[model samples]
Target: MVHTKLKYTPYFSISSFTFIMIRLMLLVCVLVSFAAAIPWLSPAYWLSPRAWPCPEDAAIAPCTCYADDDLNLFMDCQNLDSFQQLVDIFQVDFPFKKFGRLQISNSDLRDTLTAAVFPDGFMFREVIMFSNNFLDVDPDTFLPSKTELTFMEFSDPTPNFPLPAELTQLPELREAVLSVNCSEIPAWASDSLVTLTIRCLQDTEFPSPLNLSHLSALHLHHTNLLGVPVNSFVGSPGLQTLSLNNDQLASFDDGALSFTALHQLDISSNALTTMPQLTCGCEIQWLLGEDDATMPLIGIQNVTLVCDDGSGKFDDIRNVLDQLC
Candidate 1:
């Protein structure tokens, strides 16, 4: 039982050991918190405006009711400048509450929104997605329950998303702006839309046989509409403004827009050698028929019947028509 050499193991009291364990745990917690603050590591948190970084000089003022003025939230990501940056800033599946108006002007968020990025269950009054360079938007732009919106706008210049006809189910929907080369006018658009602005991206003619009986404004800009076709503005009794400006309209049909009631017609900057007569009742305030002299119409209060050939001095439509003749 005699030991030649004895090595002793260090031991601590209960309180001392507990203190050491607590310090180790605190160190792990600090590391975890630092890791979560990394934007790339925690994409969902940084994408949120609530968790976004602010300047050190911000002084940490905190108070908010409205997002900005009448708008509940305004996400101005246009400065992001790239698709990847937009994705880094806005993570998918971020939960959110209902907002009055949410205006997202992103130049880089051109991704096809097939899945829910933001919590779409929050019913919104208006949602504006605009100015993206190119976006191939999917059919379910917003959630089904969110479809009961008042106004929805997708004003990307080269958007390939077809107008989701499901928007017609929105009982309160009024206006929509889209940029897509549609082969045919969205069928259900006649249900609740009062104003529509479509900038066709392809070299195609405007879809025919439109029946927007309640539409007040129809803007078909920058397309290959080879003239206002017969029955094109049919059944739109309340149609007030018809804008087919800056397009490939070669000629207007005599039966074009005969059934509708137009108050302001804009056929500016088109290739037109002839101006077909119209029967739309009401004195149009702005009859903008560029590159043409013969102003043929039912009634026009203020008309700009001038040529794009750098000669516009006549203040009267009659004088301009006389010069062309």
Candidate 2:
């Protein structure tokens, strides 16, 4: 075995060690910069606020955005003097495109409410308009929110007004209340419409041939309807409640109450001399029990109801003639 003297060599020199450390530090710096570029990886991003809850007040002046604790947003633009002001206000950029509810009441926004009145991407779940005089609305005014809108109301006697025929296009619309001056229910087919209330401000008869298949409740108030025509409710075969309160109705066609779903029929405060003939199916429970004289109906206790199923379906019309509580 030959033993040789081993030469002593250091693992690394000082310069070499320093160079390796520098390379390691550079790699760490690169990794740190990459992490900072990603918002989810940065700790500061999580601590910072994401966005402002509502729009700035000055940007939407006269119209206010209200944010609830549950984060629902509502916009109220009521009593605006000019229609131009409304158009100008919507021209500003809104932080949110969706609102829970929109209200415009007692505003002098005359002429036509076109699609330009709303922001480009604006949508509302509920829209209420009241006391807007001489204002005509475009058919496509609410087309953008056709899927989002659920409730709509146009009350308080708008003259020369027509119910927006475009409302039939909304698939999600559920309830609607309208005050008609000269409007009539256009040919519409809605599957989601459940309740409808129409207040006739002028002397008008009932609108026939309604196409609301999903309509469960129908209320006609303050109308000059003399009688209900035959097959008046043929389109709304699913209607369960029918109210003709506060109308000048004297006669009702037997075909009007021929649907099978109608259980509650209210003709209180009307001028009916005799009980209207019924041809519906289901147990009929007359709300009148021989003592209620406030209603104009005569011999209601003795009138016979014809049932399609021979179950003796009854009509439960409330005796409270003036008040539908």
lDDT of 1 at 128: 73
Q: Could you give candidate 2's per-residue lDDT for residues 227-309 as a string of tens digits?
A: 67777788887787887878887766655545545656677787776656653333222333233452223324435544324
Top model number, TM-score: 2
On residues 253-291, what C-alpha lDDT tens digit does candidate 1 reach at each position?
Answer: 665645424556777778766765432222222232332
**Which lDDT values do the candidates have, in the order given?**
0.56, 0.68
Total clashing residue pairs per candidate? 0, 4
- Candidate 1 has a TM-score of 0.58
For model 2 the local lDDT of residue 132 reads 69
Q: What is the lDDT of residue 180 in candidate 1?
A: 64
Q: Model 1, stretches more than 4 Å misplaced? A: 1-76, 81-96, 145-147, 157-159, 181-188, 277-325
